[model samples]
Target chain A: MIRKSPMKQENRQTISGADFEEYFQPQNLEKALEIKAEYSDQIEVAAGTTDLLVANYEQLHQIKNWLDLDKIDELRKIEILENELHIGAMVTHLQLMKSDLIKEKLAVLAAAAEDVGSPQIRSRGTIGGNICTSSPAGDLLAPLLSYEASFKLQKAGAERIVRAEDFFTGPKRNLMEADELLTEIIIPLTENEREGAWVKVGRRKALVISTLTLSVVLEFEADKIIEAGIALGSVAPTPIRLWEVGELMLGSSLTELDYKQLGQEVKARINPIDDLRGTREYREDVAADVMVRALNEIERKRG
Target chain B: MQITFTVNGEERELEVTPYTRLLDLLREDLGLTGVKEGCGKGECGACTVIMNGELTASCLVPAPQADQAEILTVEGLGTRDDLHPIQESFVEAGAVQCGYCIPGMILAGKRLLDENPQPTEKEVRYGLSGNICRCTGYAKIIDAVMMAADKLAVEGSDSND
Candidate 1:
């Protein structure tokens, strides 16, 4: 329940059409970068507009000038290169769920995408917008983190690739510079066969933010756990990779006891804060319980 | 900004502010009151509409986002004289209680049938998960969509035969 402040409404000026300086719909990447360079601070680059429009409606964002990126065809492509699967930043959740490449290679990501809002929300919500929002409870971030995804950020003259784990600096904040735009996500394909699962515990079946979420990716070699990636969300300031627990499980045949220890370790490591959705204690407990359940599910599948 | 888009199969050009949402544009500018605004946010599907053959929450969509896109609202579904099969099914199933959530529910049903003609009970429930109806307990709503699918399938096969 968001409380509307009467004083805030009174302070807002009635914005009319004349007040908008410009609405730039860039046709190509070059033009979009050029506009970004010129008015980086003044403009807001919109893709999907799922989070942005909601913020604007809630009076949380005061954006004026617009750079609509929906027309840029290159940013919406999902391609499979030699070494990695390249997902354009503008690719919507529905597109991700429908992609055979994603289903075959990144099954965890596909599952997470399917768990997102609803059919209507998924049609318009993009992977880029999800990353940009950087919410601690973002459904895709945990899966992407577990998959070791990297993001390509582009500015007017140069671009850089950053690891998904390093992209977040804090809640609702990332390493994106003022001039840089997140262009693509590259998930490197591994030689090792990986089995993974994504589980999100929310208030309801649909359109509810997660109270706690877990994404587990385990690589096995002949019934021995060769490698593992464990990521947790909504129990910390940012979605975090449980490296210690993953390291502990490596090279060991995971047993029921190992799963229990992993759950206890996860409960110890997470830093949950009390909030409206849940208490700190509840989140802490659920995080461990879900992590154990996910590992058990993965182990069962490996057989 | 002046934008041109096809609404209900008609080309419409309107000068709207950059901040204008599609929900406001539909209800206020175009006078299409059939599209309800339950929650200004995307949580509720009351503002659901089919844009470019995909279901979208109109409230979260900015007005310029609809430029050159074909939009289908409740008004486009059917007329009072000739209700769409799904709409008629809702009437036959007694799916309406308050009637506030019917438009979105009908649109969701249309999208489901368009993509999957023969949906299971679980699929129907998942298809309409975005829509929330405080009344009817959703059993009748599911029945309505299932009934519509059966009727459409029979009619479709009849046309081919």
Candidate 2:
């Protein structure tokens, strides 16, 4: 049931130029899915509303309908069920930083959330929105890709899971259907000891979009690297995982691995472009440099 | 669309368009002009406020989403006659220059102190990093927050006595 607007409005105001024909806030996921299925083409799904209202405010006038998912409490939960950590799509960056569960298991993801825009942005920007926006520079993308997270996309009565690595089609583009809503992100809980780091290079310390971001998560078995996930952002059309580089590190300790060769492989895998934040050559060089430093730091910590 | 929310401890009901921003709603309708609009985008924290006990950029909040929420703008902190501890500390440290960013700075400081009663210099810097001050170079702003933490600590002990 739609909550009716209360009658008593003491301070009534109307913006002249801006208009939205309909605003729907569904209290539950079931109702939200119905609304999305009905108004699939016209409605915009709003979680934190940061990108829609701030980053892309210029396009607000063209938006005719809104499907605000704020009231759906199911999308705001962060829980661990059995061997998986289920993070609701509406979980904000601030929430991720404060979650003890996230800190213990997926600290690298939390670190990325901490590097996101200032306190205000973190408080309002949701991880699901970050994934949906599909911005290559999105702080959470590199870490999410590194963690091998999966997304739960729902429409009407059906839902499907998409791997985080395969969800993005291009910069500012994703594989989400018009009638689908990203409901939760499922990350498998690992029992192995893990060490990781999130490094972001930007113009200024705060409120600066990243020029380049690197996330490396290494699973160690008695100092031997059994599994590794290395990902880079802002160096390609989509955030990419260096599968070949990761393969080279398997079963080899940092001392046994060739740093020079691994760095060269990382540089060769990424396809960067010249933009305002950085030049293609600079990103390529820094990507290699940051990767080595991050891995070295991890090694030093393990020692 | 219509939205109902509490601003600075005062509850009010209002009619707002779907695209109407909380910044405009607070400034134009309620006359809380202390919430400045430096950068309409979320990059600059000049339009920062406390919503649902979280630091938020009012410019980025859609008015419709503010329904049934509690918001605290700079006006809610204190008046000129009786200044909030943060505002007083800013003045004592000469943290205000152009004053366009002070309201947001003051609110950010308040939010920080509310969470962390005793913040270190590094913590203060991290807390105020979101709000940029063009004139004072941020040394004094950091000092003000540190001072406020001390002042609030003393005030809390005195209240107990």
- Candidate 2, lDDT over the whole model: 0.88
- Those runs of model 2 whose alpha carbons end farther than 4 Å from true positions after fitting are A1-21
Q: How well is candidate 2 docked (DockQ)?
A: 0.53
Residues A124-143, candidate 2, lDDT per residue (tens digit)? 99999999989999999999
lDDT, candidate 1, A1-118, per-residue tens: 2221121232234644454557888888888888888887778889998888877776623576788899999999998898899999999999999999899899999999999999
What TM-score applies to chain A of candidate 2?
Answer: 0.92
The top-ranked prediction according to TM-score is 2
DockQ values for all predictions? 0.42, 0.53
Which portions of model 1 miss their true places by more than 4 Å? A1-21, A58-62, A255-257
**TM-scores, chain B, all models:** 0.98, 0.98
- For each candidate, what TM-score against the reference? 0.94, 0.95
Q: Give the TM-score (vs. native) of candidate 2.
A: 0.95
